[model samples]
Every structure is written in C-alpha cells, then in structure tokens.
Target: MTEMRYTTLGRTGLDVSRLCLGCMNFGSEQPWMMNDRDASVDLVHEALDAGINFLDTANVYSTGESEEIVGEAVASANRDDLVLATKVYGDMREAPNGGGLSRKHIIDQCEASLDRLGVDYVDLYQLHRWDENTPIEETLAALSYLVESGRVRYIGASTMSAYRLTKALYTSDVEDCSRFVCIQPEYSAVARHEEENMLHVAEGEGLGVIPWSPLAGGFLTGKYEREADPADGTRGAASESVRSYFTDENWAVLDAIRTVADEEDATPAQVALAWLLHQETVTAPIIGPKTSEQLDDDLGALDVSLTEEQVLRIAAPKQPRYPES
Candidate 1:
C-alpha cells in the first residue's frame, strides 16, 4: 500500500485522508448495489488497514443499511482517530417530516444515524442536498444545535448551486450559526462544471472541496469502450445517470485521461483521481469501491503525480464552448 496522505479539512483543524472512503455500496437493500454484509465490512477493514480514516455515507443510501454496515465494520477501531461523516435530507421514511433539512428532521436523522453508526457523534454532518422549501436560517440553526449539543462536530453541504451555497454561508455568518466547513460537489475529469464558480467560492471561503463521482460514474476509468456498451452489473449499465455521461464530449475527455494514464504507467481511474488530488482547492475526492481490488486501484492515485502540463492536457478538452463556427 502506498503511504496514505492527510490534509486539513477546509480551514478546520480536522485532518482527513486525501481519499475519503464512500460507503454507498456497503448495503444490498438497493438492487443495483452488489455488496453484501461481509464483503462490505471487509472493504471497510481494508480501507482502514490502508490508512484511510475518513468515511462518507448518507442516511438514504440503501435505506440506512450502509450506515449499519459501516458502524459494524468500524466497531473495533478507535472512534476518535477516524473522521466519520453522514448526510441528512434524504427521505429515510416516506412521511413529510422524515426528510429535508428542517430542524425536526435534522435532529431526528442525526440521532438515527448515530444509532445506526454506533457512534455518538459524526465528525461532519452534511445536508445531502439543498432543501429550498426550508429557510436557510432554519437549516443552519438546526445544524448549529447539533454542534452545540455534541451530536455533530462540523457541518457541510453537498450538491448545491453557487448562489445557494453563498446564501447559506451568509446566513450562517449573519445568524451566528455553525458555518459549513466543506462542500461536496460532483466533479471529475469529465464533469468540470463545478470549476466555474463553486470551486472559486470554496477557495475564497476556505471551505474544503471534496468531490464525489470523480470517475464520472466509471466512464473515466477506461472501462467503457468507444463502440462497445458498458458491461452488465457496472454502474454505467445500471444507472441512467451513468448512461447520460456516455457522450462524445466525455469520450474525448476519457481519451485524454487514457493518454495521461499510459504516459504515467497508471490506470485511467488512478489518473482521473490524480487530477482531482493535484488540485490545490480539493481536500479529497470520495472513492466508492465495491471490492477491495478497486479500493487498491484508487489508493494508487496517491502515488500518481501529474505534471502541470499533463494536468492541463487532461482538462483541455473539458473547457466550455460558446457559440462559434
């Protein structure tokens, strides 16, 4: 295993691993997810052994089964040494009060997630998505209460627009509530939309920027061929979201990534991950691997260093195109 690297999470004092272990595939409640209890637990152990101390999960991931699996897997490890994070705002139950960032739901879900994870407090409690229905103040206040009550150490946001994120940060500052320490956005070699303003805001505000789906749902891994369809049981074949990424533009980006991988003698997935790791603004990129082998490949990213020219080459094709020819 390569030497695991650690960095400060945003401007906070907490030090998180450069690669966050995403437990999205830990439970089998979702048909598309393939990991069973034992396999998922084994992956967690492998990640820990490999020196990863940060784990990310969501309450709605496999209907909370992922948290249970993670809880059981990390039961033997010292909790204080690890950075455990989970999200709220996803509907765990179908009831109106079962979801959203409202104070009721945030408090209820944080307790429930704590119970499922077998931990008293999560290092980072995130809003899975922005809930427009609830006032920003209400959400910030509820999260602040979590921090004050000792159920959550820090707060974060995921998958929100620049405007909403700025507004939320402003509200937190004005209300004297807990400010978001980090932001999780869907960013990858093929998906560079967040580079426009979200990344800038995160840099300006000193918020850690952790990107999920850094492989573009497996497209950047060089698994999908140009003419052939994605293999069965893969994310691309199973998820419509993944299918949408199979466009000519993304394919070109993949080619660039492949070239860089070949030059570096690394896998395309590793090269893709390296692109994110090399960014000054990125604290970490969430890596969700169904098997330990995939985890190992992801960890290889820590060793794959891209030069400034190589990084630009990989990203050149992703530059936005306005009206033209």
Candidate 2:
C-alpha cells in the first residue's frame, strides 16, 4: 500500500488525508450505486485502513443512507482521528421546508444528518450548492450557530460561482459568522472550467479545494474506448453524466493522460488523480470507488509523482475556459 500523506484543510488547523473517500455510491439511490450494505461498509473499512481519514458524504446522497453506512462503518473507530464531513441543501422531503440553506432547513438537516451519522458533531459541514433562495447572510449565520453550538467544527461550500463565493466570504467576515474553510468544485483534467475562476478564488482566499468527480465521472479512467459504446453495467452505459464526457475534445485530453500513464507506469486513473495532487491549490481530491480494488488503485496515485512536464502535458489539451468554442 502507498503511504498516505496528510495536510491541513485550507488555512484551518484541521488535518485531513490528501484524499477524501466520497461515500456517494454506498446506497441504493440509483442503478449505478453499490446498493449492498455489507460491501459498502467493508469498502469504508478498507479505505480507512489504507489511511484515508477524511470521509465526505451528503444528506441527499442516497437519501441519507450513505451517512448511515459511513456512521456504522466508523462506529468502532476512534472518531477524533477521522474527519467526518457532510453537506446539506438537497430536499429530504416533499414538504415546503425540506431543504435549502435557509436557517431553518440548515439547522434541521444538520440535526438529521448527525442522527443518521450516529455522531454529535460533524468535523466539517458544508452547503451542497449555492441556494439562491436563501440569503447568504442567513445561511452563514445558521452555520455559525452550528459551530457555536458545537454541532459542527468548520463550514464549507461546494459548486458555486466564483463571484458568489467571494461574496459569501466577504459576508462572513463582515457579519462575524463562521467563514468557509474550504470549497468543493467539480474539477478534473476533463473539466477545467473551475480553473478559470473558482480555483484562483479558492487559492487567494486560502480555502481548501476538495474537487468532486476528479476523474470526469470515470471518463479519465481510460475504460471506455473511442467509436464504441460503454460495456453493459458500466457507469457510462448507465449514467448520462458519464456518457456526457464522450466528446472529441475530451477524447483528446484522455489521449494525453494515457500517454503520460504509460510513461509513468501508472494506470490512467492514477495519472488523472496525480495531476490533481500536483496542483498547489488542491487540498484533496474526493475518490468515490465502489469496490476495494478501485480504492486500492486510487491510493496508488499517492506514489505516482509526475514531472512538471508530464503534468502540463496531461493538462495541455483542455485548458480552463468557459463554454468551449
């Protein structure tokens, strides 16, 4: 096994593993989900044993089943040593106040998530996405209460525009609310849009960057071939999100990653992950592996060091831009 490395989450004193185990696949929400309780729990244990101490889940993932699985998986482990993170902002019920960053919903969902997680407090609580319906002030104030009440240690945000993020940070400072210590964006070799603004803002604000879908929804794994349909039972065949990556432009990027992987003697997935690890602004990349073998393969990226040239080569095909021409 590759020796794991740790780093502080952004400017905070909280230390987390360089890779966060994203628990999105541990439930029966979709056809592509793991859907097996024992297997999901075992995978979490395997990741923990492999030195991934940071676990990221959300209230909406599998309708909170992911949290239950993660909670049950870690019930025996020392909680202090693990960074348990989760997010809010997705509807849990069909009722009016079921979700969003509203103070009422945030407070309610935090409690619900804690209950499902079988914990008193989450190490890091985050907003799953920007809630345009709720004022940023209201959201930050509610999150501040979570911190003051000892139900949450730190707060973060995910998948928001750079302008909104900057405003939220400014609001937190002026309003004396708990500030965001990190930001989660959909960043990968195949999806460089965040680099045009989101990443720069995160680095400037000293926020930890934990990118979701770092493999471009499995496109960067080099499992799918050009001019061919995805195999049965594969993510590409089952998920429109995965099939969306089948563009000539993205294929060009994958070609570069394959070339680098051969040179480094690493798998295409490892090469893709290593590119994120090579970035100075990235604190961790969330790895969502459905199987133990996949988890082990992702961990190997820690040992695959790419030269500056290799990193640039893999990134060169798809530079950050808005609305590709």
Candidate 3:
C-alpha cells in the first residue's frame, strides 16, 4: 500500500488523513449495508492499518449502530491518534424533539452520540442538515456550549445551501459561538452542483471540504454500462439513489472518467477519487468501502497522479457556473 498522506483540516491545527473512512455502511439500516459487525470492525482496522486516522459517521446512521460499531473497532486502538467525526439533525425517534438543530435537540443528541461512540469528546461534530425550524443562533449557541464544555472539539455542517452556511458563520461570529470548521457536501465527478456555491463558500472561508458520496453512489465506478441493466447485488440494481445518476449528462462524465482511467491504468473508482484529491479546495473525500478489497482499491487513489489536461478531460462534461456576487 502507498504511504498515506495527511493535511491540516482547513485552517485548524488538527491533522487528518486525505481520505476519511465513512462509517455509514457499518450498520444494517439499509439493504445495501454490510450488516456484519465483525466485518465492519475488520474494515475499520484495515483503514487504520493503512494510516487512515480519520473516521466519519453519523448518529442517525443505523440509529446509532454505526457509531457503536466504530466505537468497538477503536477500542483496541489508541483513541488519541484518531480524529472521529459524526453528525446530528436526523430523526432518531418518531415523537417531538426527535431531531432538528434546536438547542434541546443538539444538546440531547450530543450526549447520545458521545455514549454511542464511547468517547467523551468527538473531534468534529457536524449538523447533518440545515434545520429551518430552529434559529441558527440557537443551534450555534448550543454547539458552542458543547465546545466550551469539552464535549465536542469543533462544529461543522453538511448538505446546506451556501447562504445558510454563510449566515451560520456570520451568526457565530456575532454571537461569539463556535463556528463550522468544515462542510460535508455531496460532491463527486457525477455530482458537481456544490462547485457552484458551497465549494466557493468553503474555499473563501478557509473551511475544510470533506465530500460525501465522492463516487456518486458508485456510479463513477464504471460497473454499469450505458445500455444494460445493473447486475444483481450491485447498488444500482436496488437503489434508486444510485440509479438517479444514470442520466445522459452523467454518462458523458463517466465516459470521460473511463478514458482517463484507461490512460492512468487505474480503476474507475481510483480515478474518481483522484479527481477529488486533485481539487485545491477539497481537504478530504470520504471513502465508503464495504470490504477490505474495496478499501485497498480506494487507498490506491493516493498514488494515481493526473496531469492537468487529464484533469480537465474528466471535468469537461460538467462545467461549474460561478454566480456573480
């Protein structure tokens, strides 16, 4: 395996691996989940052995089972050596106060997440989404309290409009509350929408950009051809979320990716990840691998270097439209 590279997360002093291990598949919430505790633990160990010190999970993932699995995996490893991150803002229960970014929900979920992860303090605590129902001030104040109380070291946000993120940052500055240090946006070769707004915001603010679904739910892996149905056992066979990428525009993107992958003598997955790795604004791209073999292939992205022209070829299908300020 190639030597893992590390970078300081955004402008912070905290160092994290270039590829964050995503723990969303560690639990059995979905049919596509690995759903094997021993295998999930082994996968975590594999990542750790490969020099990945960053792990990203969510409290709502498998209703906290993913965190529990992660906690179990790290029990044998040194906690101080890893940068653990998880999210909030998903409905955990059916009743009221079940979820949202309100002060009560934020405080309550932080405790529950800490317990599930078996950690006193999480390295990064992110709001899974923007809760329009709650005031940004209330959410930031609660997150700031967590930081002051030492329950969370840093706060982040995910999957929100650029305006909302900017507002949150402004509110934090004015209220003297903990601000978001990073963003977890859905960015990949097939999904370039964030490049228009969120990426620009994160770059301008010096915030870390750790993108989720960097492979577009495996669409960029080149497993599905243009005129054929997805094979059984593949995500596309059962997941509408994965099939959603099967548009004409995305197929062109995949074609460009395929050409680049052939030139690099690498797998489509590695090339897809390499594209993200080459972006100046991206701090890390979360890799969700269900098995050790997949993880090994993903780790190979560090060694796959792309020329300037090759990068443009892969990105030519979708050009980002920057909004005039």
Judged by TM-score, which candidate is best?
Answer: 2
What do the candidate models score in CA lDDT, each in turn?
0.90, 0.93, 0.93
Q: lDDT by residue for model 1 over 44-105, one digit each (tens)? A: 99999999999999999999999999999999999989999999998888777978889999
TM-score of each: 0.97, 0.98, 0.98
Report the error of model 3 at residue 60, Å.
0.8
Q: Write the per-residue lDDT of candidate 2 for residues 1-325, one digit (tens) a residue.
A: 6999999999999999999999999999888899899999999999989888999999999999999999999999999899999999999999999988899999999999999999999999999999989999999999999999999999999988889999999999999999999999999999889888788899899999999999988899999999899998888999998998898889998999999999989999999999999999999999999988899899999999999999888877776785433
Candidate 3: minimum summed lDDT over ten consecutive residues — where?
316-325
Clashes of each: 0, 0, 0
- 120-195, model 3: which lDDT tens digit per residue? 9999999999998999888899999999999999889999889998999999999989889999999998788899
True lDDT of residue 199, candidate 1: 84
Candidate 1 lDDT score at position 209: 87
